[model samples]
Target chain A: MTTTAINTKQFMTSEQLLEHWQGHRNLTRRVIEAFPEKELFEFSVGGMRPFAKLAVELISIGGPALKGIVEKKMDAHDEESFNPKTKAELLNKWDEETEVINRYFGQISEERFQETFNLFGQYEFPVYQNILYFVDNEIHHRGQGYVYLRALGMEPPFFWERF
Target chain B: MTTTAINTKQFMTSEQLLEHWQGHRNLTRRVIEAFPEKELFEFSVGGMRPFAKLAVELISIGGPALKGIVEKKMDAHDEESFNPKTKAELLNKWDEETEVINRYFGQISEERFQETFNLFGQYEFPVYQNILYFVDNEIHHRGQGYVYLRALGMEPPFFWERF
Candidate 1:
């Protein structure tokens, strides 16, 4: 599949995208920090899944995808691989994955950003587009985290402070 | 304000970014289509702003930014400029801006992506980062739209269909 618009003109580098992704990740970590323990696991709006479940979905995707990309291994998403029983465990898992990403993202060389890789054996695209996907997806989910925090009467980390 | 991790390694082109952004915009428009009339404007979880408010903020930002980039003009964000009373009005406004973006995005030269501009007279960054910010912000809000739809017992359009 043609996964991106294919404008490989190079506006940003691998390291830059990595930092961009991590900055958003840092802000998201703050969002996780602000969540009330019970609300993180139990709060629901109009029957939507709790923020914890959604957070786990994000936590499950990133590190695994980056590992797959770096290792050239493919694994379809498996929810059973992680079943965090509490907010603390979930947060710990998220931080562990963040560490994994920081390590693995750097392993992919600059040229790799231009090569096409089948992401999770599903998306076949350049490494740059795949990296953009990771950043875009996190920002998207973080949007929800913002709402969940607001609903709980808490202020989320400032959106601009993604560092 | 250095707003991005600017390595200036150059990986994507202006046209490619525009296409990528349009793809995301297409999905978001479909998301807007999925909203129920009343819930689009009235629904809120906790004390979060309604999805309609979020949508307008997006609609307001993009077209003007593109116009600014294309014409070398700058306008600070003024929230009072829009206060849509209904979903139809909001959707119409969104379409108008999309058309504006479509027209102006093409006017940007390839080299323009490397030049720094103050997005909304606030963020001083390269044209590429500013464009990325537009896409990033939209995906973030679309995340909220997803939650609102799911909470209303509605399934959103699949997120990957950016065409």
Candidate 2:
């Protein structure tokens, strides 16, 4: 009898993907909560960017890019149209997008992960590359949040042990 | 009539700092919400480290370092206990630390931000440098989140336009 090779091409099960995504999001959320409202916007280190701008960037990118992935469409331009005047408003938007992401994730099929797509009309990469990009981006920004937290003399959330 | 010069240092009041911090936190929470739970602990990009490990490092450095800044005390061996088990538990701890940060920020005087402090018994940096680290670290992680979000076919939050 011949043994069949295991199919490594199978994408992550929806359950697995969702779990990892949520875990990362939760960690990022903790970092945000650790900050005081004042430092979130005006605080800076060594002429670097402020925490608020960085947060805006995260919002602008995460929502639309994910939407594009689900729809199988590539955005020709970067994200625009971010307008939150207060911390409350930002939180409200954050809550709204959380639901949006879940809905989008629900629609993904395993076969879709194997399909290749164009990101920002720049690179022709596999779906896996795009997925990796999502995780990488979040980690990058979270690192910035760590810096801000330290500057303010406040503890941030732990990085390891997210299940 | 002589015009009085406004102190640039005084402009960044504690209230403003708090708002900024809160806004940053809210945005980060959205990033966490972008992903599923399991990936939070297991996902990795290239040969790079997992986001979970990074979160642990953040937690370890963030709290004690902040305390050191506020108390004007520094210890070299503070980066040892940066481990956790589950994503939910990590998030819970993140929430707790947020409260501590708020309390610490509330006590900050404008004079204190300019005061210098030592970090990890190795680097002698100003309070501002330490504060900036928190925000910077967040950005770094969030960048990774962005990559993950892209891969997951979900959009990340905007980098700018945080209120």
Candidate 3:
């Protein structure tokens, strides 16, 4: 850690990262909800990944990574992440994972934000960037979700209204 | 400038933010380029904003917001943002604003990251948060772009490949 004269209190508050991340999570949950059952799992444009598969990827990352962060575990993340059978099961897992995120977010100390923890023992960045990857990956997949929804002749939830 | 013991030097670097943001911009620009010329401005789902309007809104936010951040000149942002009658015109405008973003991002300093600045003479926050709003808004709009692209039977660029 470079101890420069400048302080790092506001580089990113835990609250800010949490809220920013949760906001994306909330929007993604809505995106999942908007899809028809069959289309949610099957719809794709030009042979791209389906929304169900993408949502499963997000489910795999969020809750498990939070546990690893708090418990100092570097468990391998290459398992077949999530394979929920139905849309209802997917939503349940997403909710369960959201709770996991909230709980683990509470366990993080301000000092932990600065510590170097090897994420899954592969990506070696600070905790902040790791958390951001969660959001960035979600946004990328959710963009695919939007594509799927529009292809199915359905309107997605407004992008600006995330609570 | 809260100077504390644990240093937060690597929470985010200027280069990281630029690379991350520029990657998103490249993907969004490609999304714009993928649209059929007639549909780029006209298509919509259930009366929500069109992709073209959303693209206009992004154009308004990105370059103008960067100018505000680096130059400390908070220009009003409520006029007609971009009115390209042709897809070629819109692409030209996107390239122009991207250049503006590159020029302005160079002007920001590490110290400027810590300062609290009101974005567009409203939405006051730290400069980093403001910069993030630009990226967040773009992602949100670009999701719409993806939807539009799929509706047109076109494929958007892979989200993670740009870097």
Top-DockQ structure, candidate number: 1
lDDT of 1 by residue, B1-163 (tens): 2224334445555555677788888888788778887888888676676788888888888888889888887788765789888778887888788789989887776567768998778889888778877888899889888888877788888877788
For each candidate, the alpha-carbon lDDT, in order, equals 0.78, 0.59, 0.76
Give me candidate 1's TM-score against the actual structure.
0.86
| Candidate 2 lDDT over residue span A83-108, tens digit each | 65666666677667777777775555
- Two-chain DockQ for each candidate model: 0.50, 0.07, 0.23
Which tens-of-lDDT digit does each residue in A1-163 have in candidate 1? Answer: 2224334445555555677778888888888778888888888666777777877878877888888889999778665678777778988988898899988876776667678999888899987778777778778777887777777778788887877
Q: Once all C-alphas are superposed, what RMSD does model 1 give against the true structure?
A: 4.5
Clashing pairs in 3: none
Q: What ranking of all candidate models by DockQ puts the best one first?
A: 1, 3, 2
Which prediction has the highest lDDT against the true structure? Answer: 1
**What stretches of model 3 exceed 4 Å from their correct place?**
A1-15, A30-53, A65-81, A85-91, A102-131, A143-163, B1-10, B44-50, B79-81, B109-116
Chain A of candidate 3 compared with the true chain A, TM-score: 0.90
Per-model TM against the reference: 0.86, 0.48, 0.71
Residue-wise C-alpha lDDT for candidate 2, range B1-163, written one tens digit per residue = 1112111212223453455555565666566655667776676544344566655665666566667667767677444565656777767766677777776665555556566667777656556546645654665666655555554566677854244
The alpha-carbon lDDT assigned to residue A44 of candidate 1 equals 67
Q: For each of the candidates, give the backbone clash count.
A: 6, 149, 0
Best-to-worst order by lDDT is 1, 3, 2
